[model samples]
Every structure is written in structure tokens, then in C-alpha cells.
Target chain A: MNTRYIFGIIITVVLLSVNQAFIQYWLAQKKHDANTINIAGKQRMLSQRINAEFYRLEKESASPHLLKKLVAEWKTSHFKLQSKDKSNKLVPITNSEIRLALKELNPNIEFIESQLNNIGKASLNLSLINQNQNSFLPKMDKIVKSLEKISDKKLQFIIKTEFFLFFMSLIILILEVVFIYIPIEKSLNLANAEISKKNEDLKQALTSIGKKNRELEQITYITSHDLQEPVRTINSLVNIFKIKYARDFDEEGIKMLRYLDTATVRMRDLIKDLLDYSIIGKKREKTKIDCAEILEIISKDLALKINETKAKITWGRLPKILGIEAEIRLLFQNLISNALKFQMKGHQPKIDIAAIEKKDFWLFTVSDNGIGIESKNVEKIFSIFHRIHSKDKFEGTGIGLAHCAKVVDIHGGAIWVESELGKGCTFFFTIKKDQNKIVGYEQQTELYITS
Target chain B: MNNKLNSILLVDDDEATNFIHQFVIQDHGACKHIVTKLDGQEAFDYLTTPNESGLPSPDIIFVDINMPKLDGWGFLEKYESEFGSNSSKIIVMLTTSLNKYDKERAESMNVISEFRNKPLSPEILDEIVEKYFTNKHMVQ
Candidate 1:
């Protein structure tokens, strides 16, 4: 769009300069033609002066010096006017009539010059000088008239050529505006309309997403409240029956009651974890959190389990990062707890936590010496409710890793695991340095609702 | 003992929850008379009008948040407008909602005395009575 205008202006400037140079050259030629005509006119007057002076010398007996000077002046001017040599002094003779006339005057000028050279020694021919001067005057007049006509023709040609060049430049300018500039403007308008239409579509999509998020939130609340209500009643009623009718129950009935108790306890824990996962990003604001401090708090919370397993926990210098405090704490807690829980039978657990500074974020790792997961099931660990071990072997709802995944995602990062069936596992995750770059679901929903 | 409450009101949409709460209150012997209503609207109507049994005004009203025909918040609004602020009656919000927003909402209102979870036990009822009422033995 911008280059078209620049190219059009450049072409116009080139055309104008070409016309200017041509016109200047022609004007300079016209000045030279006028100079030549002035000299031809002067030659005619000098011829008459020489003739009259000679007549005066014949009758009054004056010095021949004055007559000689006039002849000398007339000879030089005639030579300059009638010379056919192609040099600076040569005037262009275009008309054949003017050429023949200048040729006739040349001989007369030479005859007068030869007579003046024999000043006092020979008698001067006064009658012959008069006849030659008369002939020279008429031809010089015709030559001057011809030179004037030629100059006028040159001037007319220059004017007509200048008009033609100017008209051509105007046509080119109009064509440039019609083809280059107008079309560019039209395409720019079209692009602008397209961009605004896309913006409108994006706004509508954001609104619909906000509505969906709100509906999902409502469903979570309903599950937590309404669904848990009946479960709580059942659990409590069983407890009440157990307390009131313990003596009446046989061994088989007692076993069934204990099974019911276990099932209800597991169901409650499942519901609580599901609620916690769904409520991850309800707090949209982020704050600076010290990872070392959070790890210390988590280790203290798991002191009982750590003591029972005789575990050795150590960490390198951790960083202060921008994230939701609770979510980040939960992330570390889950990773550390998993490291403590999944262990090799009768083996001492050793866990290490460390962080490395990357270009745009901080990479963290939690490695543990435990009963490692199989390589095939490594990718499946972060999925909700995906457990590799049976319920009889491990006590877990398989939600901890999935919760860690959610936390990392909200912080604009990723989570993955590297493990083998017999070797220890290393869990890796990233946290962005700038919290504002995080486009978590909660932030987008809040923006749509508030705006 | 002055620790005993004169009259208590129990409001909930769930029949089992109200039954359990009423039984616990009765078992604790915390109050002289106990009134049970199906929902917040029925409880509000019962409190506003004179009863056939000629029961006294309740000292503590346990209102559940989620109910049909005027929920806990709606009933509170109507009660506040009718009785005005600084009423002597203690209003406790009882529900099964685990949402933090609901707890924050209950705390923000001045008319609500406390927020408690569902299935009120005998120990919880005894604590409420001991906290609000004067126990002459403790004073001695």
C-alpha cells in the first residue's frame, strides 16, 4: 500500500525532469539564433558606413585610416555571419534562400576589404564601392528576416513539445491513482472489515465459554451438597443401627456391616477428592509463594508417615514463584505424599526435591526410590481415577497426580513422569515466572463475566 | 438449671435430617419444647403466628440453607424485616453445602448467630445450650 504511492511520485518526478532538460536545451538554442541575427544586422550597417566613408575620402581628401577601420569591422562581421564551418561561430543556415543571399554578400565584403588595403598608393573605386554596398544591404536584410523566421519556428516547436510532455505526465498520474492507490484502499477496507468480524466471533465464543463454566460450577456444587446428603444419611443410619443392635447381629451380619462401612467411607473420600479437583481454580488471583517454605510445611504435615517409613527427605534451593498459594502448596504436597506412600517393601525410602531456573520458567523435579511404575503405565498416572495397583494393595483414589497436573496447567506449565517397572520414578513440572501470562480457565471466565 | 433452653425450632427440607436433629435435641434434654418444620417457609409461618399448642417463642432457631418455598436467605430477609435487627433470638444456619461462599455469606449477615453442618449430634446441641444459656453451677 505504501510503496505504490512512492513509486508513482518517483515516475512523475522523472517525467518532469526530462521535459525540463529538453526545454532548457531548446531555449539555449533560441538565444544563439538571436545572437547570430544581431551580428548579421550589424554587418549590413557597417557596409553602408564603409561606402559613405570612402566617398567622403574621395571628395574631401580625409585620412584612409578611418575607412580602413570600417572595412576591417565589416569584413569580420560578414565572415562570422556567412561562414559554413561547423564550429561555435557558425550560425545554422536552415533556408536555402538565406544561404544563397549570404553567399552573394560575401564577395562584395571581400572586394571592399581589398580596395581599402591599397589606401594611399592607388586610386580608390568610389562608384564600385557604392554599388557593392547597395547589393549587400538587401541580402543582409533577407538573411536577418530568414533567421527570425527560423527562430520563431524553433520556439513554436519547443512550446508544443512541452505541452505534449506535460499532458503525458498528467495521464500517467491519473492511471497510477486509478490502478494502484484506489485498489489498495479497497483491499485495506476489506481487511479491516474481516478483522472486526473475527473479533465479534471471538467475543461470542468467549461468552458461551463463560456460560458453560458457570453451568459446570453449579453442577459441582449440586453434587457436593445434594448427592452427599443421602450418602451422609445412609452412613449415619448404619452407625445408629450398629450401636443399637450390636448384640443381635451374628458373625455373618457383622461382616456385612463392616463391608457397608468400608464402602461408604471410600465413597465419601472419592466425592471429597472430586470436589477438590473441580474447585482448583476458583481463586483466580496469584501471589508470590516460596517453594522451600511450602515444602517444609508439607514435610511437617507428613512427619508421622515419614517416621514410620524411616524416610530421608532432602531438597536443594527452591525458588519463589507466582501462583495461587493453596494450589501450589497442594501441588507439592501431593507429589511428596505420593513419593512417601509408594515404596518398595521393607526398603528405606529416599526422596529428593530440586528446582532449576530455565529461560522463561522454573523446572522442578521430585524423585523418589519407591516401587516404580511400569513404563507403559507412566503416562496413565496423571489421569483421574487411573490406578495401576489393585485396591487391596494400594490405598488411593488415583487423584493426586491428576490434581498436580491441574495445578501446573493453571500456572501455565506442564507435568510428566519418567519411571520404569523396577527403577525409581522422577516427576517433572514447570511453573511460569510471570503469572500474568497464565491463561487459566478461571481467569478467562472472570474476564467474560465482569466485562 | 438455667442452662436449659425454653423452646427450640428445627427447620430443614430433609425428613431424616430433621428427625435426627429433633431426636438429638430431645436426647440431650436441652430445651423444654422442640418444634420441627419441613421447610424455611413453614418455620417462618409457625414463628410469626400464634400456635395451637401455645408454645413460647423459640430461643434458638436452626435453619437449613437449601429448602423449597423460601430458602434460608429468603426467610432471614422476611424475618429481619418483620422483627427488625437486634432480636434476642439466636439464628443458626445448618446445611450440607461445602462451598466456602455459603459460609462467608452466613458470616457476613448480622442476624445469623452461627453456621453448622448437617446431622446435629447431642454433644453439639449441649455445647450450644451451654454457650448461650447461664449455667448456675458454673457461676457458683
Candidate 2:
């Protein structure tokens, strides 16, 4: 929503991502360490059990001669202890052939201990006991070796797995830092910078526009007001010249004086038009004005020009409008005046004043039978200080139509002209219809009574 | 006859305008000595003053709207209240400005004659002069 909020969110997001990752990695490492330690403990316990069993077996199997004597004793003890399991009836000891053989082989095994004495029977007894047997000691040792080997391999595998996970977690941390956190942070900074730059640019643009607007306003004021001083001075100077030097001058001097007078008047008109142009936007003087009455008044004022041209004005119903009465009068006066001024040398000006019903506005046309404008000069006539006709042809500073344009702009209307050279011209303009005032009442009461 | 006939006063700041008015009035062979004052206050003082010699009391006043001090409208505002008998004086508005507010205000005044435009035309001149002439002759 704001710079501060964006910064706060970025910090929040970054911290959350880092902290969550840290927490996840830490938990994973803890789980791994716990499993590793548990496995190590189980391996140690297994090693201990294997060592104890191997030691006990080693102690018992240390002396072979003693082992044989113990074995014979264990056999006799085993026979007596196993009597219930196997003794349905007892056979004499000398009657069993296996025993007879064992007795022969043992003839001197117990009695003889000489260095060269014949010990074949003892050897034979040893062979019989060794039949169908594998030694427990070597097998147990091999088992222990294999178990140790397996646990060692398991420990190595677990360690490697934990190392790989540790490195993977680190890589993930690095990648998150590089790809997610760092770039997003960078982008966030860039976003803030870009917006800040744009904001600054916008502010600068607005500030300059405001400054320019004020300067333009000030220039307009100075041009309209301060510029009047020199014009008034020139007018006063002309008056003084006419009073003091008029009698002394001959016909040419008088003609020059008249020329100066016309030029000065043109200058005055120009200034007034410029002032009117500038003030149009600032002026908001609008009241309910009867448009038809204004037209009738303009008709009266332009009577002399119309008479000179021998023009006839026909009218379709002109509706009442919302405008400053004086300005609208001036607007109509200018249009009608132009029509009267631009008459063909011999032709009587036949001007028609008519209003058209438009969708959103009232479109009015003032068509003339005067010598018309060229298509190109129609636009030229509305420019400041631009005159299509020379002074000898038409009298104006070309500011009149410009002023009309400005007024129409103030009223939110479009003013355009359609003309063919040497034929006739029609000036079309649109003004918003004031829906607040009804046309029927004003027309019936006014048109009937006034005419 | 006495109520219908009275002296008229002309109050103005511009000498030329008043002179032209006097000339026009005299050209028509009306009264020779129409009382004139430089300002509204002078006219007021004259009207309310004692009926002294050379200070003929005014029956009507032609007041120019724009003046230096105590303008025509201002004079009328004070006249009706302070000197109640002065209300009988016909007060005419003479101004260049056709401001509707001024016209309405002038019409609403107690002793107002009518709101009219300046450079009073020959037609109005003859009409007003004829009425006052008969009244003047009757008084004589």
C-alpha cells in the first residue's frame, strides 16, 4: 500500500523464509544425529555380547588333554543323566562293541604317560569324538568379524548419508538465499526504486505544470491589463495630434491621420479581442438568456450592414439558451456581421438563420448568400491576427472569429464552416440545450408577444 | 397647480454633460434657469436649505448615477428619510450602465421618476418639457 508497508512486508517475508529454512534444516540434522547415535549404541552392544561369548569359549577350549579327560567324564556323566531318556533296559559296559573298542583304545590311555609309549588308542578315541563336527571358536570369531564388518559398513553408510544431507541442506540454504531471498529482495528494492523514481517524475511534472500554469496566467493578466497602458497612450496621443496639427495639415496629412486612426482602432480591437480570449475561461457569467431575443437584437444592430448588402434573413425557430447574454449577442453579431461584410459585389445577401435539433445539443447554422470562403481559409480565419481577406476587402483584425471560438469553447461547443469559393458560406455551431428551461413556454409567450 | 409645478435641479460631476443638457433644454425654449449643482450633496443641501433668494427650491432632480461624492443613488437614499417633504421631488436616474440591479433599485426608491439611459433623446425631452411647461405657465 505504501513504501513503508512494502518494506515491512519484504522484511517479514525474508525473515519468515530464512527462519523457516533454518528451523527445517536444524530439525532434519537433529533427527539424523539421533538416528546415528542410536545405531552406534546398538552396534556397541552387539560387539560387547560377541566379545563375551568368544572369551568364554576361548577359556574352556584352552588345553586339549584336559578337554579330552573332561569329555570322557562328561560322557559317563551324560550316560547316567540321560538314563531315563534312553535306558529301557541296561546293558553291561563290556558287552557294547563301541565301548569294547573304546576300552581297547584306552588300554594304556589312562595308565601310560611315557614319551615313546604307543598311544594309538588315545588317537583313535580323539578321531571318533572329532567326527561330524565343526569348531565353535573359529566360527564364532568369523561371525563376530562379519557382524563387526556389517555394523562398520552401516556406520559408514549412515555417516555418508548424514554428510550428504548436511551438504544438501547447505546447498538448499545457498540456493534459497541466491534464488529466492536475494533476488526477491533485490527486486523489491528495484520496485521501490522504480516507484520512487516514477513518483518523483510525476511530482516534478506536476510541479512544473503548475508553475507553467501560473506563469501563463500571470502573462495573460499582464498582457491584458499592462498592455492596455501603451494602447491607451497611443490613442491619447492620436487625439492630441488630431487636435493640435489637424488644421495645419493638408489633404495628404489628413489622409495619413485617418490611416493612423484606423490602424490604432485595429490595434485597440486586437487588444480587446486578446483580453476577451484570455478571460473566457475565467469568466463563468451565465444566466437564463432568451436566445431568440438576442438574435432579434443583433438583427437590429446589424440593420445598417444588412441594408447595405440588401440582405434578407430567414429564420427557423431559435431556442432560448443558457449563456451570458452580452457574449452570445456578440457571437451572433460577429457571425452575421461577417456574412454581411463578405457579400458579393452585386448580389443581395440572402442569409438564413436556422436551428437544428441534435442528439445532445442544439446545432445552429447561419448560412449566407455572400461571397464565400475557400475551404482552406475557413480554419485560417479563426486564428489570432490571421485575416484571409485584405483590409481593402474586409475590415477585421481576424480576432473576431478567434474570440468566437474561445466563447464557443467556454460553452462547450464546436464551431466550423462549410463554404465554396464565390458561392456561399454556412457557419455551424452547437451549444448545449438547457433542459432546465422549457422551449414551448418561452417561445409561445416571447415570439408572439415580441413580434 | 402649485403641487404640479416646481423647480428642477440638475446634479452632475461632468461640466460638459450638464452644459450640453442645459443647451438642449434651452434650445427647446423651456425654463432658462434650471438649478445646477456640482455634487449630490450640494443638490441635497440646496433642496433642504431655507427658501433663500437665488436658491429656488427644486421640484424634480436629474441625478447622474456616477459622481465623485454622494452619487445619485446615495442622495435619494438619504433624501426620502431626512427631509420627508423632499420625497415629492421627482428623482430621475441618468446613467450609461444598463445594469438591471441599478434599474430595479432606482425604481424602488420613494421619489423616483424613471430609470432611463443617458443623452436623453429629443422625444423624451419634448415629452417631459411640455408637461413641465404647462405646469410652469399655470403657476405663473
Candidate 3:
């Protein structure tokens, strides 16, 4: 959009500059034409003055010296009339009638000059001189008339040229407005309408998605609450039956009862894990949390597991970040527990936890020397109920890593793992330092709601 | 161990949960008497009305959150406003809800003494009796 405006402005400036240059050139040409016309008019006036001097010489008794002075003045005016300089280059006139008239006037000027010279040379008959001067009078009048006609024609030509230029400039301006400015404005309006429409559609989609998400959360809460009642009943009733009737039951019956007890207990644990996974960030209390403190709490919680696995856990200096204290604690707890639980046979687990500050966030890594996951199962491990090992081998409802992912996601971060089979695995995650700043998909939903 | 109280009250909408809870309490022998109410309203009625035999009020009341007529929160509101300030009866909220909001609400109310998940086991019942009832004598 900005580029379009800039391009339009550049084109308009160039066109206006070209039009101004043309107008200036035409105005200069008109000024030159006026100069030429003024010179021609001066020449005609000089011829009339010379004629008057000749009449004055004939009528009044003048001394030979005065006649010589008048003749010299006439010669000077005649020479000036046809004087040529750098700017005054004589060219043939364009109009044929004006050219022809000027041709007649030139010879007459020559004839008059010769007559004056003859009178100056001898004090001859006065009547004959006077007759020649009378003839010069008519020729001077004719030359003046022709010069006036040429000046009028030049004035008319200049006015016509200016009018034509004015009309052409107006046409160009109108064409530019019609073809360029108006179309561009119309398309801009159309594009704006389209963008607003798309924005409205996006808003509607986000609102509906938020509504569906809310409904799903409600259903999950209700389902988990209601389902636990029966499971708990089954568990209690099973326990009561074993306590009351264990002596009468056979060996096979005892094994079946124990299986029932195990199934009920596992079901209960599954339900509990599911509930925990669903409520990860439901009640977030954001504040400045010290990562070192949270890690200490997690280590204490896993003291027994750490002892059983003989895990040599080490950590670097952790930074204080703005986040939900409980969620961050849970995130560390899960990773540490997983590291302790997935150790190779006869291998003491070596777990390293550290945080490195990046440009806008902190990158945390929990690396473990454990029975590493296969490349293909790295992504699958984080999904709910995607267990890579059988329950007999590794007991889990497969919701721990999923819960960790949720915690990372709610904080506007990403979590992933880099692992090779039979070697070690490193789980990396990022947390933005600014917890109050909303980011990513959550920000979009927030905008939709507020708007 | 000697029975900790004269009577106990259980408030829950589900009969099966109440049954299991009653069995757990009976097995633990924490109280001499146990009364079961289907919902919060029934439990409230049982508490407000006087018995012809002149029995003492239950030492502990266990109420569930989600019910048809009246919920645990509604019961707590009523109980606190009416017979709350001087009564020595302990109120323990019991529910299958894993929602943090419910737990937080329970924690904020001064009348509520404990929040426990269902269905109650003998060990949990014994712990509650030992902490609230047995500790009362020690404090005195």
C-alpha cells in the first residue's frame, strides 16, 4: 500500500516537471519573437524619420553643413536598422506576404539613400530634389504599414500557441486523474473492504473456537468428577469383600480378586492423571519465581526416587523468571522424575539441569544418561496415552510428558527432545522472561475476546 | 482406640459413594453414630431440626460439592450465616472434583476445616478423627 502511494507521487512529479519545462520553452520563444518584432518596428520608424529630414532639407534654406549633419544622422539610423549581432540573426520571414512586402521596402530604402547622397554632393535643382523626397514619403508609409502587419501576425501566433499549450496541459491533467488517481483510489477502497471482511470472518471463527474450548473443558471436568465416584465405589467394595471373604476364597479366586484390585487401582490412577493433565493452566498465578527454589522443592519431592536410582543430579545457577510458580515446579518435577525412571540396567542415572539466557527468553535443558528413546518415538512420547514401553516394563498413564508440554505451551514456549537409542537424551524447553506479556495463539484469542 | 465422637454426618448426592464412605467410617470405628444424607438440603434439615432423644450435634460434617437441590458451597454459605460463629462442629468438604477452583473456594471459607477426595478410606477417616477430635482434648 505504501509503495503504491510512493510510485504515484513520483509519476505525478515527473509529469508536472515535463509540463513546466515545455511551458518555459514556449514562453522564451515568444519573448524572442517579440524582440524581433520590436526591432522591425524601430527600423520602420527610422525610415520615416529619414524621409522627414529630406523634406526639411528641401523646404527650408539650410546651410551645406546642416545638410551634411542631417545626412550623417540618416546614414547612422540606416546602419543601425540593419545591424546584426549574436542574438539578432536575420532569417527569411515565414509568411510569404510579409516576405514580399519586406522585399519591396528594401530597394526603396536603397534608392532613398542614393538620392540623399547625390543632393549632398551638389547643390543642384531644388524642385527635382523635392520631387524625389515626395516619392520617398509614399515608400516610407508603405514600409511602416507592412511592418505593423508583421507585428500583429507575430502577436496572434504567440497567443495561439499559448492557448494550445494551455488546452494540452489541461487534457493531460484530466487524463492522469482519470486513468491513474481515480483507479488507484477505487482499488484501494476495494482492498480495504476485503480486508475488513476477512477480519470479521477471522473474529467470528476465533469466538466460536473459544466457545467450543470452554465447553470441552466443562465436559472434561464433569466427566472426571462423575466417573471417579463409581471407580472409588468399586475400589472400596473390592477392599471390603477381600477383608470379609478372603478366608473362603480358593487360590484361583484370590488371584482373580487381586487382579480386580490392581485393575481398579490403575483405573483410579489413570483418571487422576487425566484430571491433572486437563487442569494444567486452569488457575495460573503469575509472579516472579526463582527457578533454584522450585528445583530444590522438586528434588526434595523426588528424594526417594533419586536415592533408589542413585542418580547423580547436577545443576547450574538458575535465573529468576516471571511465571506461574506451580506450573514451573511441575515442569521441573516431571523432567527429573522421567530422567530418574528411564535409566539403563545397572547404570547410575546422571542428570544435568541447566538454564541459559537467550535473546528474549531462557532456554532450559534437562539431559539424562538413561535408556534413550528411539528417534521415531521422540515426538510420540509427549502425546497423551502414547507409551513407548509396556505397563509391566514401565508403569505410567503416559500423561506426564503431555502435562509438561502443556505447561511450556501455556507460558508461550516450546519443548522438544534430542535423543539417540542406547545413548542419552536431552530435553530442551524455553520460557519467556516476561510472563505478563501475552504471546502466540493465546494472544490471538485474547484479541478476539476483547474486540 | 476409643470412638472419637458421638455422631458423624455424610452429605453426598450419590448413594453408592455415601455407602462406600459409610463403610469406611464404620470400619475405622472413628465415631459411634454415622448418618447419611442424599444432598446438601437433606443434611441441612437434619442439622437444623432437634432430635426427640436429645442427641448431640455431629462432631464432623462431610459434604460433597455437586448435587441437585443444594451444593456444598450453598450449604456452607447458609451454615456460616446461621449457626457458624459459636458452633464447634467441624466441616470437611469431600468431592470427586479435581478442579482447582473448588479447592480454592473451600480453602477461602473459614467454616471449612478440610478438603478431601472421595471415597474416603479408613486411614483418612482415622487421620481426621485423630487431628480434629483427639487434638481438641490435648489443646484443652
Candidate 4:
């Protein structure tokens, strides 16, 4: 089950337990009130019984022993009602009104006891009999009436208490439903609706972005293919002209033709590089690739340049990773070639390639002792066609490092450089251990460019 | 590089590319007869006509991929259907497309013997004639 439902159940159980405890306390109080009413009624009955015995003794003029026993019983009943001896007394009425009624009845009870005592002393005194028949019997009746009133009042108090408890229980139920349950349910529904709406918006944005990316790829592919034909035609015609009709042109005409030829070649390179940049992750073949093997191949490919420049290249142990072998080779080639191309005047280029095994990837570093880049141009170096040096100074299309950046990004990694102007530079890039964790080329390319 | 083939055909949409390629072929002197067609449709029509019309079927046909009337793939499809039995004539696909898919398709097709990038040179012409025509001629 969901946790929300479990939490709600827990809250409901707690509220119900609290309500049940309150009702139990009220019920216990009601039970005590009923016992108090019962005790007061019993006291009223005893007082009435005593009054009847007194009348009987006055009229019959016989059975003095029975009269004395009855008098003793009345006295005992009165003491029990008052409960002066708390330990031995049975009835313990703690209500203030009941105690007040008992106090008022105490004087009447004492007078009746004294009158009975007098009758016992003089068994045939007419005046004592008259006093008992008139004043004492009426006083006993008043005491019984007061006890009945106290019982009635207790019954009314119990009825009011029960009604109040029922009303309080209903209010508590409404409060729990209104304050806790309803608001929580309403907010939960609102949050669900909001999340679904945001999800839909995100889905639509992703779809549109994917469509735009595919369109851009198609446009790049077609433009590069179409653009190359004319460039090739111009280069071919110029070559034929330079070969077949070179003696027919003046010096200036020949120089202009050479310039045209150079421009056409550069344009072709630019178009080819653009196409390569666009198709970074279009189709990839992933295999277990050894960084050491790739570096060996790159060194062999650049052997002539290395010999001419007298550059020294060394490497430490490299880890075996999963990637597209050709792309990795290209990446290594570009960085090593850049190192060779950007050497300081009369300085033998020293390039070092190494890989460190990280938790999820291999961090590869290519350090070169060449003319390093300025700090501000570090980010700009990876942007397409962003050339910091003029073509005369540095013969490059400026897409080499950008292509390397794209390749690293396709492998779900980051690329950056730490360099100081006129000093040596080190370029660091990562390659994921698992090729299956590659990101989409379009998204990663955008991130690489922006970041 | 003695003349190895009787004739060769060049199919391309771009006039400049055809002109330069024809110049290279003529400069190499690899074949006595050379024909240029504006598109694949013109080349197809020229090839399918009766051989007795004083025009011999070229031993090699270089077909450009992007054309106005009929593209290289379209011509290849029609050419295979029309001339499937003519195994002696070789068809080579030529284009400036660097797309790997195009290369793979050209390699996979039975009618196409080779795929070449555009702007053919005299050395390439000489190589093609020596590789394909000279051996066959010597065998005959």
C-alpha cells in the first residue's frame, strides 16, 4: 500500500483512541453520579422507616424493647448517611449539595434521637408522646424530602453531562474530517495534477527538440555533400589550368590562380570538418579499445611529422576502455597533431599521454610543451570555427579541438584544458568505462558548446 | 599506357565536372572514344539503343550520383533490369558524397563495380583502364 494511506490510518487511529478515552472518562463520571443518587435514595428510605417506628411506639403504648431497637437503628442509619467515621462508613457521598443536605438533616436526626431517649426514660408520659407525634415526626419527614431532592438533582446533572459528551464527540469528528483529512486530500490532488502537467510539457519539449536535431543533421549532411561538388570542380579545373597552360599566364596571373587554389582547398577542408562535427554520434560501433594501441597507431600515422619536428612523445600505462576505436583514434590524433603544430620557436615539442582509472571512467591527459593558449580563450577554443590565431600564424580549420570535444561528449564525458600563455598546456578528457552509457550527440554537443 | 578500351562514357549533371573529367581522360589517351552525358537518363538512353547504330557500347560507364532527371541509384536500378545479361560492360558509381551509407550501398550492389569520388584525374583514368580493360583485352 501507499505510505499516504498508512499515515492517514495511523492518524485516524490516534484520534479515535483519544476520543474513546474522553468518552470513557465521561462514562465513569456518570457511573459515579448514579451511585451517589442510589445512596441518597437509600438514606431517604431509612429516614422514612424511622419516622414510622416512632409513630407506632406512640400509638401502641407497648413493646418498649422494640421501640429502643428501632431508635438504635435510626441512629446508626443517620451516622452512616453523614459518614463521620470515614473508615467504617459504607456510604461516602462527596457531592457538595448532598453533603449540605446531610448537614441540614443532622439537627433533625439528633432531635428525634433525643425525643426517643426521653420516651425510653418515661414510658407512659403523655406530653413526651405528644411531642414525638407532632414535632419530631414532621422533622424526620423534612430530612427524607431533602435527601430525595438531592437524588433528583444528581439525575438531572447526569442527563446534561451525557448530552454534552455526545455533542463534543460530534464536534471532534467534524474537526478531524475538516481540518486534517479533507485538506490533505485536496492538496494531494492538486499536486498530482501539477506534476502531470509538467510532465506533459517536458515530453512535448523533448519531442520538438529531437525533431529539430534530426532536421539539422539532415541539412548538414546535404549541404556538405552538395558543397563539395563545386569545390572539387574548381580545384580540378585549376589543377588542369596550372598544368596545361602555366606558360601562357603572366607572373601575377599565376599567383592569383595559386591563391584561388589555396582558398578552394581550405573551403573543402572546412566543409569536410563541418560534416564530421555534425555526424559525431550518428552511427557508432562500440568495442573493447585499448588506449595504448590507439596511441601507437596515432604515433605511427604522425611519424613523418614527428621526425621532421624532432618531437619526443612518451606515455605511461593506459587502461583498456569500451568505445568506438576509430573515434578514439581520431581524438588522440587530433590532440597529438595540435601539440606538434603549436610548438614554440626552436623548441622540440614534448607530448605525454596517460590515463588514470577513475571510479566510472578513465581520465586521459595529453600534456604538450608547446605555445599554450591564453586563459580567456580556453572556452572559445572548442567552439566551431573559433580561431584565436590567424591562418598564416597557425594553419588550422579550428574544428580539431571542437571535434575532439564532441567525441569526448559522445562518450558521456567532459573535456577541459589547463594552460598559461607561452607555457606548456595539458588537455584533460574522460571516457566512460561503459560505452552503453553514451548521451545523445545533439544534447551533449549543445552542452559542450554552452559550457 | 597503350589505348586499352574502344570507348568510355561519363555521366554527370555538372557541366564543369564533366568538362574537366573529359579533359583528363583525353589527356591520358586511355581510350579512343569518349562520350559525355548530362544526366543518368541520357546515358541510359545512349546505352540501350541498338549497338548497330554506329555507336558501340562503352566498356566502362562512370555514373554520377546526384543528377537532374535520373540519379545514379535510379539509373542503376533501370540499367540492371534492361542490361542484366550484358556482363561485359562495367559500371562505376562516381559522386562527391562522403556519406558512408552511399559508399556501403555502392559496394553492396552487383551492377556497380567500383565507387569513386568526383573530379577524376588522368592518373585515375589510366589506372582504371589498366586494371579493368587491359587484362580483359590481353585475355581475349
DockQ for all models: 0.15, 0.10, 0.25, 0.27
Q: Which residue pairs overlap in candidate 4's backbone?
A: none
Give the winner by TM-score: 1 or 2: 1
Candidate of highest TM-score: 4
Interface RMSD to the true structure, each candidate: 8.4, 12.6, 10.1, 9.9
lDDT of 4: 0.77
CAPRI band for model 3? acceptable
Model 4 segments more than 4 A misplaced: A1-177, A439-451, B1-4, B48-53, B73-87, B99-101, B108-111, B135-140
lDDT of 1 by residue, A323-415 (tens): 999999999999988888888777888999999999999999999988888888888999988888989888989999999998998899999
The most accurate candidate by DockQ is: 4
First chain of candidate 1, TM-score:
0.58
Which tens-of-lDDT digit does each residue in B1-140 have in candidate 4?
Answer: 57777888999888887788888887888876889999879988888776766645888898888788988888889988987835678888887666667888889888898888776877667677777877688888
| Candidate 4, position A67, lDDT | 58
Candidate 4 C-alpha error for residue A175, in Å = 2.9
For residues A242-285, write the lDDT of model 2, one tens digit per residue.
Answer: 86689999999999998898888778777766766655445345
What's the lDDT for all of these models?
0.82, 0.62, 0.76, 0.77
Off by over 4 Å in 2: A1-330, A352-359, A374-380, A383-403, A418-423, A433-451, B1-8, B19-29, B34-36, B48-55, B85-88, B119-124, B130-140
**Candidate 1 chain B, poorest ten consecutive residues by summed lDDT:** B131-140
Ranking by DockQ: 4, 3, 1, 2
Q: How would you encode candidate 4's per-residue C-alpha lDDT over A146-249 as one tens digit per residue? A: 55566567568766866776676677667766766787788889999999999999989988998897788768866775677778778888889998988899
> What is the DockQ (computed on Cα atoms) for candidate 1?
0.15
Which residues of candidate 1, in runs, are more than 4 Å off? A1-221, A440-451, B1-7, B26-33, B48-54, B81-85, B134-140
Q: lDDT by residue for model 3 over A1-451, one digit each (tens)?
A: 5665566677667767876886786566556556555656565455556556666766674654655555565555444444444344432346566556555555555666567667758555545545655664565456456655766675687678667867776776677677777888899899999999999999899888977876676567556655667887888889988987988999999999999999999998888777677666766678889998888888888999888878898998999998878888999998988888887766899999999999889999999989999999999999987799989988888889999998998887899999999888999999987776754334321111000
